[model samples]
Target: MKVFYYLKHIGLALLPHSWFTRRQRKLEQKFADQQDYIQRRVDYYLKTAQPFTLAPEETTAIADYTRRGFTSYFYDLKEYLHYFPKQCRFAYYFGDETHIEPRHTLFKARPIAGDNERSVIFKLDKRRHFRFVEDTLSFAEKKPMAVFRGAVTQPHRIRFMETLFGHPLVDAGQSNPSETHPEWQQPFMSVEDQLQYKFLFALEGNDVASNLKWAMSSNSLVFTPKMVFETWFMEGTLQAGVHYVEVKDDFSDVEEKINYYLAHPEKAQQIIDNAHAYLAPYQNPDLEDLVCIKVLERYFSLSGQLEK
Candidate 1:
């Protein structure tokens, strides 16, 4: 399995852009029938399910992009929403991001699905369980520096790395087309290995970093920049000092933040504990289902669909 994974990665790296475009087109064509079926299923589920009791002002129309890349999180959300009870009052507007535009609605919790884009799907329960090196380690025992491993996709990431390249407080390196070494040459770090560190850097890539959830799950304090994007978990809902330390997007204050946290170990641990507590409600799969139901209820109430 490892060999096949590497071979595919290498092939993708060597393949031309046109090859991926053609592959994407083929994927859209192949999933067209399944997409149509899912859409119909969604309609049936919403129209026939038990009615929810909501206030008059709660009913509103929600717009979701119907035509999305097969791998998009929005596609998964569409599938999940099907399991919800039929909400006759809730109305759906199906269109792409370009047409619908993401408002401060339930849909904003999901990543924007687009053509040839890499995105993180918000599924806390479906992650790979990693075997830790040991049961526990003290804050002093773990590496004092923050660790970050990901591809250099955006210019902001590149600039951040360049500034902190040789900083003692940071053990940052690239995993995809690795900056420390060649692509697919170095062994990937397991989640357990990352948990061994005192601090974890959750930087944005093509979209939000998938590692952010795992970081929050761990005992280590998470440091991330103010995100322009959000997932179903809503990073915006988390407070900077309470849940995770917020770093400047330009990364000018990363070093300062790290130094302060290291000096005040108690404060850092408090934030880590708070983050875990904040995420506890979302740890269950049932909460996601409830969120979908509530979102629909609100949409229906706001749109005056119940009056119909």
Candidate 2:
């Protein structure tokens, strides 16, 4: 899959300008029936006032790579920008952009709810963030214990592992080796291994949880506290006890939530179905392209760059 990702990048980078425009035109026609949804997405992601030009010094010219090393963020972000005008100006702060001030447009994988105006999120870190799995095992076949396996990046996660490390109903742990906290470390588990559990933790780390997308797409039920950050996946829209089972901030109810769902398999299945439905829009690549195009168009227009 990594090889495929790089190859796709190489192909896009080499592809001529006309090909991208035609692809967008093709997508527009192909999904013409879904204009309302496409516009809604574009508006949701971009809600800033129009006709405001950012200073040239504050903006960046469109290009292939923002810096020397090309990561997945560049790949995803450039996919939306390269086809646009070369003179187009924009500001971009890559990586976990927590709070972006006004007129300071930043493109990142995760944007907190309050910063949505200029955050301009796309699926930037595609290699790690966009993972989908096909689970053949039913909820009945999976273990009853809820499971979490990820890097202990946040202090909140450390507290989670400390509180429930020995709990039998939960099999949660920090999967990465940490010299500072060897006790919190456990051998890394693949997403496939996590599918074995009935409940999967979509705990937030530095940004939105990378596992949330793939975990919600799986057969297992997802457990998460309220999400403060969002991406193209629209994490903020996810409902507690509907799309996923909500966990308290203190995480005092992990076992209780897991146990309640275990006793009522039907209710768990409904939430799983709702999660799949919520993810339905993401299944269409054309829709994503259309939304990306509109987002950039609105961005440039609002930046008062249409005259260029």
Candidate 3:
């Protein structure tokens, strides 16, 4: 993503540089046109006539969930996970003592060097024990700055989802909602792909959330499609199963995960099956994309994007 942006910028930068030299700036123009086309497509997606932001039932359910500090975790996750980067010009996340600490503090975290130190800490609310490691000049320069130590265990991961979501993650090998219409059929879009992108986008919005968190096996590593469904769904609701899982905050890692999944034959088959089961609910072709889009609209509204 950053490379795309840089290429787009460098291409334009060449225009000014070329003006002084007067050679054919054809390549620069091509890059500029490409960038513009990409931007236009994104704008179209955003501006398309979306379904209502949320159904009345959905709004009521979400409001009730929030009072308990639990909303539709998947929906919120999807919004914060995906839509942000495509929308915001300068989007980044920061983790610091203030947001990570038990309570808010005046010592806020900033991007650049200051009193802020790179560190990793785990807070177990039940035990009230904060386990952490301090940062040094050496560690900060590496590719991924370490934060939380010890991989989040599977049980703990489930517990975390339950805590934030008010329920367990969806289960695997469960039945999908029965299709209603005779014309309904599975669409081409991949549900797992949509989920990965959405999750990545959400991670991008949080300041404490690292770009490496997904690749490092924190949230991304732990949440496989099978595991995600198993954790979220009920006993029999998820009919088929989960397909591929990819969670990477970094742009390069994102592309790598996509490629890795694509290349793995066995994994790809499972992913396809899982996505089909998930798509069973929206048997109507028109409603398949609507499912994701409507969820996102609800998310943005909850996050105050729809407010006048």
Candidate 4:
């Protein structure tokens, strides 16, 4: 297993740049298809709700790529922004983060939405790859430790994992190209497998951790570093210590925090309960549909396209 893992990484490292480019193109196509499917669903819901009534002239055709094929994640901002109208009242962005200058009217969406101008609106997690767990283990039945499985995309994540390695209460690893254990060949844990643990570590990669949403749905207490990024479900709304345990950005005190939680099981349990309560609303598909409707209505209103 270890040999296979290292060999795979080595093979990729030895491959030419074009190989990765082709692989990325394939991934982009897959993401585009998923986004289109979600857009269809949103359209159906909007039509059913009849959230806004607009005349032909009042119906502003915002350049929405939600149903079109375009790279939303890890895109070239300058190149992508060129496709949007410069002086439009509002342009919707489905990318991971919004990079358009405040002078422009474009807004970011998905994962985390909103930009420096606060024009971006929040939307539910749209990636079809996420595994949504309807059932989660109780805190008492969960493993009394923390676990993280993801790619090592940023240096801070690497440092964080290194600091927590070999800790008695922490069980962490990489899913792809295993940074911490390059030689270890372990299959990526399913979302259900991860929820069995009492504590789940949420770390950033490329953008905010998408797993954070899944973790919130579970009964486990999430321990994360100070987040510089946010997703559709803003992290700011969650109170640290109550909804989750926040470690330093550098994760220097992760061990100490884990020890504290271990000694005070009741306190940790309260945090777990709070997390479950806060995320309960998102579990409903109807609620997500309503959020989609609200986002579109707000966009239309702000863009001056909604009929009086």
Model 3 residue runs over 4 Å out of place are: 1-28, 32-37, 44-243, 246-265, 268-308
Quick one: best lDDT, which candidate?
A: 2
- Tens digit of per-residue lDDT, candidate 1, span 154-271: 7878876777766788777766674453532334677778777898888876556667777887778888887755554565467889999999888889888988988999999899
Measured with C-alpha atoms, the lDDT of residue 65 in candidate 3 is 24
Ranking by TM-score: 2, 4, 1, 3
**Which of candidates 3 and 4 is the stronger one according to lDDT?**
4
Clashes per prediction?
A: 14, 0, 27, 3
Model 3 weakest lDDT span, ten residues long: 119-128
In order, the Cα lDDT scores of the candidates are: 0.55, 0.80, 0.27, 0.58
Candidate 2, residues 231-293: lDDT per residue as tens digits? 778777789888999888889988888889999999999999999898878877778778888
Decoy 2 TM-score against native: 0.93
Q: Can you give the lDDT of residue 277 in candidate 1?
A: 84
Estimate TM-scores for all models. Answer: 0.60, 0.93, 0.19, 0.66
lDDT of 4 by residue, 179-240 (tens): 44674334678878888888899886666777877787677878887666654455646788
Roughly what TM-score does model 4 have, to 2 decimal places? Answer: 0.66
In model 1, which regions exceed 4 Å deviation?
1-75, 83-138, 178-187, 304-308
